[model samples]
Target: MTMKKLGFAGVMIVALVGLSLATQAQVKKGKTRPLTTKQMMAGLVKPQCAGLGEALKAAPSDDKAWEELATKAALLNESGYSLMDDGRCPDGVWASACKNLQTASAAVLAKIEAKDYAGAQAEFKGVTASCGECHKAHKK
Candidate 1:
């Protein structure tokens, strides 16, 4: 290869190596900042749960609302499952929280389907209670 081409290749190699080292340093620094339970729950799970709550309040008798709540609950449960898989929390705690949330949400949907407005409202309260209970225990 020509000297000019070889020199250009050498510069590129040096730049790549520098970039790699910088990235590794940043990753190490980030790891040192350890994620808090509140941070994870608020960032990754709470928005969806809040949305489900809003939808439930506004459209208690609406099929679409019930379906949306079910979908959001499922997503939250999956997120909790993922956290457990990553060893971020004990499997039992994670599973219990997810299952409680899922069950309560599903109960609301079922009550709505049965045209039991009062029952649905009660189930909605149960769902919120489940979320609160889990947060109290596991969230920061």
Candidate 2:
């Protein structure tokens, strides 16, 4: 009777472990599916761009503020690359816009690193313009 009970307990543990592994596998597969364009824009691009815009409103007075601006620019650059990743880019226009965004954000980051507020502001305009161009082509 003890042997039978142990056998049953062992089988239950194995079954539970298998179930947990299967659940985790499913979740990993789901994560591989890319975010929708809207999701990417709202989750990353928009917020990052907004942060850059707000930061550009005034020159950084200290190292912390400058670092914040640089962080936003880098995030915006990454978001631009993400826009084109995972087969999300639909056409040349989308590609062009994404490239423009990357270039602009890089420029903004460079200016921020140099502590050049005016240059950063100038480059930031290109970032916003790239967004507008893409929206004009695709947004409803």
Candidate 3:
């Protein structure tokens, strides 16, 4: 019943999906064709998250991997905001979770920027954990 009990990621996703009917009528994030939020989730968010995972698997000494992770983090950060835009979080915990996700993604970027491999790995895990938390609650 409560946001905490509901799981921020899951509740946020459900909230986003609940708004799909409204978004479906409009062009997807200013695309040529219309797309439901669910479609975007499948098309945009999922692959990008996978890319993030791949970046995480890269060797720490791999500069190219860190670069890829930075790029993926930026994209994922935007995707996170896009998932629940206009501050449409379901509740306080949901909002906090969303913010933490965004922040974690940024941390990923920052760690890569500083060439802090260990920090980047930890942040990558943090990002993954947030996604898992939400998916557990909402992903079908």
Candidate 4:
């Protein structure tokens, strides 16, 4: 092979290797430890709930934020479904609490989409109450 062609090939190989390493590093960085039930509840679920609440509170005047919040609520509802279906909340009391939260979230989302802010706010309060009730019953 010509010297210039060999040099170019070497550069290409180095570029490819660098790209591979970069992707692997990114995957590693993105890897998260599997969350315990409480961690999942506290770290993932509760924040989503709070985001929903904040979004709803602000949505009255900010249509864009309201839509974003509604999306977050929907995502949180999906997460709750996974938690329930996976039997993650094995304690009967905790399971019941999760169930209630799921119900309240659904109701709240429906109200929000219907532009019934009042109803959504009420249901949001219920959702938070359900969380508290579950914690009281099952949290150590």
Q: Which tens-of-lDDT digit does each residue in 13-126 have in candidate 1? A: 878998776644432223244654456567756787687667656545566665666677566656545444433444355567666766776776677567566676677676
Whichever of 1 and 2 has more lDDT, that candidate is: 2
lDDT of 3 by residue, 1-140 (tens): 77788898979888998777444433233234354556766887677778777756655567776677777788878877765664334444445556777888889889888988778778877777777766564454
The lDDT-based order of candidates, best leading, equals 2, 4, 3, 1
Residue range 1-140, candidate 2, lDDT tens digits: 45477698787887899877654443222225656667667878899899889878988999999999999999999988877665556568878998999999999999999999999999999999999988897675
Lowest-lDDT window of 10 residues in candidate 4? 24-33
In model 4, the number of clashes is 0
| Cα lDDT tens digits for candidate 4, 21-134 | 654433222224454565666777878887888766644666775677678678777766656653344457666776787888888889878878788888888788887887
TM-score of each: 0.50, 0.75, 0.63, 0.66
**38 Cα displacement, candidate 1 (Å):** 4.7
- CA shift at 29, candidate 1, in angstroms? 16
Q: Which stretches of candidate 3 lie over 4 Å from their true place?
A: 1-34, 60-64, 86-88
State which candidate, 2 or 3, has the greater TM-score: 2
Clashes, model 3? 0
| Cα lDDT, model 1, residue 128 | 71
Candidate 3 TM-score versus the reference: 0.63
Report the Cα lDDT for residue 115, model 4: 78
The residue pairs that clash in candidate 4, if any, are none
Reference-based lDDT, residue 24, model 1: 47
